[model samples]
Target chain A: MTKKRLTPPLTDADIENLEIGDQVLITGTIYTARDAAHKRLVELLDEGKELPVDLKGQIIYYVGPTPAKPGQVIGSAGPTTSYRMDPYAPKLLAIGLKAMIGKGSRSQEVKDAMKKYKGCYLAAVGGAAALIAKSIKKAEVIAYPELGPEAIRKLEVEDFPAIVVNDCKGGDLYEEGVKKYQK
Target chain B: MREISVEKITRTVRDLCIEAACDLPQDVENLLRQAKEREESQFGRYSLEKIIENVELARQDTVPMCQDTGLAVIFVEIGQDVYIAGGNLVDAINEGVRQGYTDGYLRKSVVEDPVFNRKNTGDNTPAVIHTEIVPGDKLKIMVLPKGAGSENMGALKMLKPADGLKGVKEFVLKTVAEAGGNPCPPIVVGVGIGGTMEKATLLAKKALARKAGEHHPDPKYKELELELLEKINKLGIGPQGFGGRVTALAVHIESYPTHIATLPVAVNLNCHAARHKEAIL
Candidate 1:
């Protein structure tokens, strides 16, 4: 059976070119949200409220950062686990969200959405907050500061490293890698 | 009976929490370097490198090792002869956590309620504290700053007494296998066997505080720990589950006697960055 390679999500090809095991430094815009922000985002879609930012071809990072130190753009910033946001992700993808960034596994429903919508999910190193924070040149909370760490922020990153856990072509590094190495 | 002051214990605990968050323990640091050398997969090697960099950055800059900085969880062993002077012991411990988090510039992740009105407490207060009474005059405190990434994957099950050793092994492997790369591969497996449900969970958490690579005193349990570690690595969960032979840095299991009819088991996964520090007062 012939399969079409899906359209890539980012303005830059680095994210698109990222292999399952290859490390790529990412730059450009990525949005941030956690459990609370995700709930509000889906609610906005239900009420048809205007989204704070247009997600078309945009990546969303699941992170809740510590407060920044003096002269720092942001505090220790690292990705949280992706599973908590799995339930709301496909809905966001259906409406044009292009990418998701976090650590750990995403649900099959979210992976299917990636295939259907031509989106991708990336995994950043889980506990490397300070190193990940260095990639963020700019950060501004776009919504829900009341949620503190869980607030949604827009980050401008440079050469941020991540693994392609799920790609638009339905390739999942987690399962494939496990199967390849399992004895 | 020996008398212990609440203020002294609280002050010591407060320092330990901050220290644990800012400085990756020496043993954990050495292990990461070792894991890097032992990692055959290129991605696994890369992950280990990044982890070492994170540790350096955290120590030099006084930033948290992880964004989660985790909920401040404490395990205390107090001698029956000791007394917490000047105030309630639990309250003092909570105050210590509040000051430690605030002064450390750590993220406040805890909320006032689990369900409605999940409002941030601002200071990361009201810590989850567990106290055990032992026969002695000393106080020992273990602080584990548990990240949500791995904690979300924790599980507990009640097996029939007949399930025995094989059942325990199966439950642990299944849990780790299901976790895949999500718990930040090269994870620490903490297994608690025997005891009631809550006791089992607490035991699993306490097991994590044992120095990495250390095993239980019982020969049977030590063998079980080694076996579980080998089986988990065989899952090929690898570092970050990208594919390698080093899925687990160590497997530490703690057990207690239980009712003849019950076999309660709890498994807690700790990410490679097992941020913990201890102090005795």
Candidate 2:
């Protein structure tokens, strides 16, 4: 299948154009965060403090990459299950987060927020970390180094592949796909 | 009595950890390739292809196949005539895990406590070790780096004898269906029937260490395994749960005799990664 190429700093139009199950090849900058980082980011928001990184028009990848070996930009990095971030996702979406890249299904609250906020959720193939890493040209920890692998990192990616699992219109590929194929 | 140095055990454990992270065992790789070929859905085929490629890339670069390098789970079979010299076996295993996580650049995912502290353990030490005593003089060790995505999807049920086989099948199906896209399919379903609650869970985990597509020794259980595998794949959860004919690469069942009044069942899932490695000393 042909994949639509998407670059970060996505506009509302970009998100609206996506449909559940559409293949995408994402290019440009994305931020990395997982369970621990999400907790801290939400905490900062609750405290009425500035976030370490801006959420506006930015995409956050739910991943905790293995340590990079010598001479490598990053190690195998795949999407973790996305539901763990459901609690914090809507809050980020409210702040203008345009999209998220992760694996698995999102909760109803997060899906509703995506529809209301003109955001989308994309799924990178889980257990395909080495292939995903090939798309990342550079990575540097931008915050919470103490969180180790969970630290927030700025990544420059090229042709990073994902599928639109939840679209702004409230379509869910997971549910739709399973229904289509279930015997 | 045969004496084995703690130093040797530690070093071997360390090597196994690195190997388990970097290499997708041939059994798993072969199963994935077959699944890729067998998958009917276009998206499912695409996911499997990517998984296969990831395995190749991880092996070539000596990097982990997936970032969640997992909690180090060690299984050791100690011979009755053998003795571990120089240190306690548990400490030696933990030390090995420390060295391996650091040296291999694998992620340290363990938290010190489940609820209160929730602090990172730093080195992925304090491995969940299971020991069994056998009759030989050799020591056998197996390391399974279990990622959390699938691990968190595990389920257990204590049922009355009246529940029977029908209850077991329904429970397994419900667990996988509820899991949906979350457990990182196509998953290996490890089912444990009988035993006490904890024993059933352990048996389910041990089931994962078996070769994919291999059936239980008993003809009865093997037939049940095939039946369950068919039912699960028919669910169309697919690769990464996108929907396809290849939702499960295998269904493994390990059972133990149970009390007259009790029937306990546990399900443990391993993602497509399904990583494990072993050594004999």
Enumerate residue pairs that collide in model 2: B185-B240
lDDT of 1 by residue, B140-166 (tens): 888998887889888999999999899
B37-143 in candidate 2: lDDT tens per residue?
A: 88988889989999998999999988999999999999999999999999999999999999999999999999999999878899998899999999999999999
For residue A53, give model 2's deviation from the true position in Å.
Answer: 0.9
The CAPRI quality class of candidate 2 comes to high
DockQ of 2: 0.87
Tell me how far the alpha carbon of residue A21 in candidate 2 is from the true structure, in angstroms, after superposition: 1.6
Task: Give chain B TM-scores in order.
Answer: 0.96, 0.99
DockQ of each: 0.74, 0.87
Compose the digit string of candidate 2's lDDT tens values, residues A74-149.
Answer: 9889999999999999999999999999998889999999999999999999989988999999999999999988
